[model samples]
Target: MLRLLYVMTLTVCCLPLIPGLGGVLLSAASYLPALGLNEPNLDGWHAMTSWPGSGTALQLSLFTGVTATLLAILMTFLILQRCWGTQGWNRIEKWLSPLLAMPHVAFAIGFALTFSPSGWLFRLFAALTGETEPYLWSLVQDSQGFGLILALAIKETPFLLLMSLSVLKQMQVDRLLTASRSLGYNASASWLKVVFPQWLTKMRFPIYAVLAYGMSVVDVAMILGPSSPSTFAVLVWQWFNDPDLTQVPRAAAGAIALFVACFGVLLLYRLAEYFLVKGWQSWQFSGSKTYSLPGKYLFGFVALLPVIIIPVLLVWSFALRWRFPSLWPTRTTTRFWEQEVGNLLELAANSLILGLVSASVALVFAIGCLEYRDKYHKSVPQLVIAIPMLIPQLSILFGIQIAIYMLPGQWHVPATIWAHILFAFPYVYLALDGPWHSFDQRLTQTARSLGHSAWKAWVSVKLPIVLPAILLAWAVGLSVSFAQYLPTQLLGAGRITTLTTEAVSLASGQDRRISAIYGLIQAFLPLVFFGIALAASRIADPQRRLARHADKQVSSNELISTKPNH
Candidate 1:
């Protein structure tokens, strides 16, 4: 049974990559049978290279991608360093779910609405200046892609922090901190020297995921990124959308270039980690200064940024007449919501269906993979599982779509769902990885000793123990599916109208009111699941229930003792 499940997992999760990558690579080589170009050549490469601003676009991608990733990691580490055991950690933990649930496109929509030229900040300035409007530049579509960098940094920090939570939990962080303090180190110095290196090593994969995302994201980049010469990913996306069928090779080459560039960034990260943590031992001892960041404030801002963003989205959605130089809406109505209610409901249903199906399938496959590894003491490679995440979506989607076209009948819905699973599986698996590794095996053994079969033992003991993690991973998978943009766009071929697709489409119109409606819907869908996941995790956790029961008993004892004294 385990072997069958292991086989099923590999087939479901990893088999798609073969054809996906193969098709893209073949297309990149200019071997387009559909275009009647039978011969493989470098024409596509030449065309892509010779395109105006192509080089600059790649450079822009690299700059924004690398810088954003570094900023997110720095923010994550600083927050973990300063707030991990503090009161601020509580707030940070409380907000991580909502922050993580915010889709990139939704966040970008709110961000643009708040920070654009005639946006809220500008209105604040205009009110002070006693002007209805003024000529002012804003971060939206900044030529340097700085706005995209900032947005990505702020958006991805929550993911990094969440990943760190699993790692820190396994490390016995309190013990490490106590031991470091006894060894003549303050909290700041101890965190920097004693904990930083180890955390970075464990954190390298999540960092790679962030870096890849920063480089390859299209929806967020489209909403806030520069337009003159867009990021390389945007360029490739445009190429794929070009009407000319013969232009497919150029798009393929560009995807290959993106794939290579992303790999380069990952390599750079590995080298930097190696050298910083292992190559230089002196830094571990050289830092005696109590240099720490204001991470409490940083996390508060991180938490607060979304607070402002969500309300901004909600207010914009209903504002019948919201002009500049006004903090509050002058007029508001629900007619917009009323008008789009049916359509939005359809989109929401489609999106919810996709998210649930994909996440559930991915969750089952992830459990099988982890269980296989536990039973057999061998597993699929981590690199294999992470390929979908680490590679650019555009790099594989084009080829996958073509392969779909080759199939008979309408495969659009199935293809789209498969694409979601392909992408969502990695995140789901990684989410479960930490908990699966940390699980104590003795409980499972004890169950087996009671004459339970292997499957029964797992279900009776191990499953309940890790139910919280499983639920959280399922939420992560659902959010991942909800956030998917390009897959639905290319694969669904207009037959499927997800909230994400609608949100991005509405956002493209620059209609703040309508865009806000979709953005709020898109953002809210995942938050509902995340809220459920958090609540369920807490309620389902045996340890938490025990602790609550113990507290109740202790309070009862104290009351009884105090009554006699009184």
Candidate 2:
């Protein structure tokens, strides 16, 4: 049974990456036969390098992606240092789920509506100053990358916090704090010197995930990024959507470049974390507190912006007569909802089914893989799981599309669902990895010694023990599936539509009502999944209690059976 599970896990989670990578690699090198480019060439590479403003675009992408990712990490560390295991930490913990639940596209749209040139703030400025000259500003689509960086940073901070929570939990922050405090250090100083190094090490994976995500992000970048010299992922996305046949190879090359850039950034981040935190251990010993982070203020500001943004979006979605210089909507109607209701119903159904199916499948495979790893003392490589997580969606997706077309069937629902599964599996695997490794293995052995078969022991013991982690991984998978843009777009072949693509495409036209409806629905999917995860984790608390009760019963039964009267 265990061996079968091992094989099933391999088939479900790890094998698809071969075809995924192969398809992209072939197309990226211009060896695509379907497009009549049988002869491999460097033309695609040359085209990517020679494009107008390409260098500027790459620089802008780096600036926004790297800056936002690092800033979020720093903010996460500060928040943890000050608040972890403290009274204030509870409030932040409560907020983390909803913040993490908000979709990137939704957050980006709301951000623009709140801060852009024609946005609410500017209108307020016009009304207050009585200057109708309409001073020109284009911050929303500013040629520089400030808008993109700010939006990405805001969207990413919540994720970093959530990730930090997991790391902090594993680090035994309370014990470290107590130990350091006994050495005469201040509370903050104890955290900086003792807890941070361990936290940083555990945090490397999430940091890499963040960096890769920010660098490779397409939907968020499209909503808030500069237009004249767009980010690299956006540029690759445009190329993939280009109607011209000759541009496909260029798009493939761009995807390859994105993959490379993601890898390079992660490598650099690892080196930097090592140098600052690990190699220079002296800083932990000798340095005076030079860096005083405004952590509470940063959290307050970051948390406030999103709270304000959501209400503003709610107003825009209902407003019929909202225009410049108005503090509030002049007219309100459900007509926006009325107009979009039917389309949203269909899109919502599609999104729900996709998220559910993909998340469930990934969960099963993840559990199998982890169980197999425990029993056999072997496992899949970490990099295999992370490749899909780190790589940009647009880069490999076009090749996957071509591969789909080459398969003996037309694009269909199954293909789209499979694409989601492929993408969602990595997140599911990573989510399960920590808990699985940390699980107490002796419980399963004890169950087996009690005359339970291996399968029964696992079903009756291990599954119950890890059910919370399983559910959380499933939720993570669902969010990954819900936020999918490129895979659904390319694999669905435009016949199948999801909320993310709808939200992004409509956002291009600047119709806030229509876009808001889609954004709300997009945000709702993850919230629903997260809610389920939270509930399941709570409900599964019974398993632990039941196990303890059963163990007590077994001990009592044995004591009674061993009477001395015989």
Candidate 3:
């Protein structure tokens, strides 16, 4: 049964890549049976490269992706250097989950709300200057994509910071810091000289994920990116949506091109890491000239954004009248919420259903794979599992969509759910990786020895211990599914709508109140689940039991030492 289950898990998580890539290659080659163009040709590729502004779009993607990734990495490292072990770190941890849970769509919207020409900041500036009009200067939809880069950088920082936690713990950062300080290295120098390299190495996959995400991000780019050419991925998405059947091949070719771009960038990043960290030993031992980042303030600002954005969205959602240069809405009501209450409930239900189903299924598949590895002494590799996350969604989904059309029956809903699972599985598996490895197998062995079956032993012993991590992983999966915009948009065939899809769609519309309502709700649902997970994890944590056990042991040992006989 375990072997069978493992095979099923592999089928779900790994095997799809074959058909996905195959279908894409075929479509890119102009072998489209549905379009009656079964002959292989390179016309699609020709059209894609020759498309006006394709060069500019490609440059935008690369520049924005690489730059944002670098900034996020730098910010994450500096934040760690300044506050990883400090009291401020505790507060940062409290903020990480919700901040991490804020979807890119919502983040982009909030960013625009705060920084656009007619946004709140401009309003404030106009008010202070005694001007009746908003400023013409803006960040959103800039021709240079600075806004896109900024949003991507800030959004990815929290993720890198969270991943840094596990890496930092494993590196025993405190001891490293202590040794570095003894050698005359200051706090900044110690972190830079001692911790940054290790953190970078350990965070390679996450960095890759972020890079791919930044490069392929569609909704966020649409919200804040330039309109002239937009990002390459967005262009491909638009191409795929073209009503002309002949454009499908060109779109497929673009997807393949995007895949190549992501693959090349990831490879380049790997080589860079190798050269910077491993190929040269000089940098590791180089003089520790320290420079402090304004990390405390920077992180405070980054962490405080959601606190501000949420209220702004809330205020906009309820605003009946709010003019430029006014700090507060003149009037507010629940009319907007009330008007959309039914639609809101339906969207919420769809989102909840998708999140619950995908997260639960992904969690089970993750558990199965882990168990199979333990029982059979074999498993798929981490990279294979993470392929879904590392590759551009546009690339894989294009081919997957082709495959769906090849099928005679309705595959949209099933395919979307499967895509969500495939993407979320990597996170789920990695989340459980530490816990499952650290889990004491002896308890299970003891249970098995005392007349329990393997399954029974696992259920009675292993499950309880990892329950906290399991819940946490589930919460991660839920957020992942909730934040899915591309999969739902592409695979749902416009027949399905979730809060993420609606939020992204509304972001493009002129209705800020409606957009804010959706964005706020979209942010709220995932946060609720995450809050529950954290609270439940705390309640169920095995550490509490172990700590209590240690306290009793300490008391008994002290009592024995101070006995009257002594």
Per-candidate TM-score against the hidden true structure: 0.95, 0.89, 0.93
Against the reference, the lDDT scores of all candidates come to 0.89, 0.80, 0.87
Q: Which candidate achieves the best TM-score against the true structure?
A: 1
Q: Which lDDT tens digits does candidate 3 get at residues 52-121?
A: 9998999999999999999999888878888887788899988888897787778777888888887887
Point out the higher-scoring one by lDDT: 1 or 3.
1
In model 3, the runs with Cα more than 4 Å from the true position are: 289-293, 375-379, 442-453, 545-566
Query: Local error of candidate 1 at 479, Å?
Result: 0.6
User: How does residue 105 of candidate 2 score in lDDT?
Assistant: 84
For model 1, which pairs clash?
Answer: none
Cα lDDT tens digits for candidate 2, 1-566: 66776676566555556666787778767887777889988888899899998778888888888998878877777877767776888888777777777878888888888777667878789899986644478557788777887777777787778777657767778888888778777777887888788888887766777788888888888888888888888998888889997777788888888888888888888898889887888878776643454576677777887788777788888988876777788899999899889999999898889989998987877777777788778887777676677777776667667777788867667778887887888778877887886788899899999999988998888887788878878888888888888888888989889898899999998898888778877877798888988887877866667888999999999999897876
List candidate 2 stretches off by more than 4 Å.
Answer: 12-14, 123-139, 289-292, 459-465, 543-566
Ranking, TM-score, top scorer first: 1, 3, 2
lDDT of 1 by residue, 195-225 (tens): 8899999887788889999999999998999
